[model samples]
Target: MGVGGIGIWQLLIILLIVVMLFGTKKLRNLGSDLGGALKGFKNAVKDDDSAKNDSTDENQPSENTDESSSETVDITAEKVAEKAEEE
Candidate 1:
């Protein structure tokens, strides 16, 4: 089908209805409010980026472990197999 199944005539009709209902003055105020909201959102995003760049210590862990970690291996497969056979 067409995009949103709406023709140019249908869009024009909808626009006419909106203009009649809200009028030019209300539409102007709505446009200004939308512009201000978008500007505020952009400023908020920029502030977030600058805050992330400035505070490097906030991302780092405060404590470091002094103890050494060791790995151990066990070879008890044969014993486990014998126990399974007895069971």
Candidate 2:
């Protein structure tokens, strides 16, 4: 049993059909674009989490919050998604 009842040969045939339909160049571009989007999403989520954690830390001094945060731009997940879709 290969992949929930489909045989190995069946899988290969499906793959071949897909390759024939899309061609390798288009498939490669699609794969890379998808991968890049996923990577960007992960980074955005990680950065957002880290920002939240830092803000919640009691040990950090609250003095001059505006001055310290001025250098960094806050990126929301929605903005990231829109940019990914554009590309």
Cα-based TM-score, every candidate: 0.61, 0.64
Predicted candidate 1 versus true structure: per-residue lDDT over 7-68, tens digit per residue: 88888889999999999999999999999999999999999999988797678855864445
After the best TM-score superposition of candidate 1, give how far the Cα of residue 72 lies from its true spot, in angstroms.
26
Candidate 2 at residue 57, lDDT? 97
Tell me the spans in candidate 2 whose CA falls farther than 4 Å from its real position.
Answer: 58-87
Backbone clashes in model 2, listed as residue pairs: none
Q: Cα deviation in Å at residue 65, candidate 2?
A: 19
In lDDT terms, how accurate is model 2? Answer: 0.91
lDDT of 2 by residue, 1-87 (tens): 798999999999999999999999999999999999999999999999998998789677766677656666556877998899999
Worst 10 contiguous positions by lDDT, candidate 1: 65-74
